[model samples]
Target: MKDQITIVGNIGSDPELRRLADGTPIASFRIASHERRYDQKTSSWVDGTPSWYDVSAFRSLGEHVLASVKRGQRVIVTGALTIRRWENGERSGTAAEIEATAVGHELRFGTTVYTASAPRREEPAPPPADAPDPEPVAAGAWAAPGAETPF
Candidate 1:
């Protein structure tokens, strides 16, 4: 089973984008999610320790992340989670990571304008030289009575 998780956090650093030898692109960054609590005695809000996660996005998503995300920006990321432990000499630590499937701005903090990307397509092959021509449709032939044609 896959361990999937979603996190809302502030980006800790600019995304680093790189390409593999096969030309596949990947972007990596870190995010810190802090917990806020109300302290009754102090009568104030306090910030708890933050949980940090390293995130990576691949392919077109990576390209878009490199172009759109920045350090300190609030974002929402959803992906598969991974935890790893490592030791160097006598020191050891655990690392949390996410292989992000989706990354986007957290709109509660701000607004963003979205632009649609162009659709990808391959050129259609030319018809065979000896093929018969296609039949032409009469103007408004497919339109119902009293219905306006989109064209």
Candidate 2:
């Protein structure tokens, strides 16, 4: 996989939002990017094969995606790509996904207003001294982003 990947495409589905018991937010969606080619026989441009990516964002980035992105909206995503193979009851296939670090509206498609949010603290807040450590949240309880999640 590449160290980093940048893709510009339209959101293929609505962003699914959820929060961990501790209040950390998560957002996920699918993006479809296509290549266009000029066909001499057709005498016009034609769409080549489309590539789909299952994208996920976490914490404040996740919150931003949930609030901003929507189905069919053009956007830019910068992230890391991971590939996996799975076998389920005799069904097997490969999956491609992106762990998005940044997501935003594609300015080339149209104009959009931007509201910058405050930055997060460098150090996470410690739980109250009197409070017990909270249990980790299970991913199974929440719906996976897109058709699958990179667990």
Candidate 3:
């Protein structure tokens, strides 16, 4: 089985979304995770070297990510890690990447409001010119006031 990686960090930049030729959506962004160590001398926690990673998410998840995530927001991501070696002239380095399977905001640091997105549905064809206008329906129980609850 392939190894999976999970990282909890702050997004270092705004997510960029794109579509492949076949119309598959993808979103890419950078994340920075840091380790803290306690120092007896200063008696305080200090940040160690931060690890930076490139994260890519695809399809509907990518769409949702683009809409929900933003720079500096804490997030948790899980996916397969990919390492690639590269060289240019006399310089060489290894690139770290994650093909993200899941991504979401980390709520421990703050609060967020959750709203359900409207479901997608195909519209019916327009009625004949002689057809009467459809009657409007009243908002149902689902739309009742005070329906939203804090997470």
TM-score per candidate, in order?
0.78, 0.73, 0.74
Task: Output the worst ten-in-a-row residue range by lDDT, candidate 1.
Answer: 142-151
Candidate 1: C-alpha lDDT: 0.92
RMSD of 1: 5.7
Write candidate 1's Cα lDDT for 1-151 as tens digits.
Answer: 6699999999999999989999999999999998989999999999989999999999988999998999999999999999989899999999999999999999998988777676566788999999999777577775654456677
Runs with alpha carbons beyond 4 Å of true place in candidate 1: 123-151
Of 1 and 3, the candidate ahead on TM-score is 1
Candidate 2 ranges beyond 4 A from true positions: 120-151
Clashing pairs in 2: none
Across 13-105, the per-residue lDDT of candidate 2 in tens digits comes to 999988889987889899999988899997999987879999989988998899888999999999999888989998998877899999989
Q: Which run of 10 residues does model 2 get worst, by summed lDDT?
A: 141-150
Evaluate residue 91 in candidate 2 and report its C-alpha lDDT on the 0 to 100 scale: 100
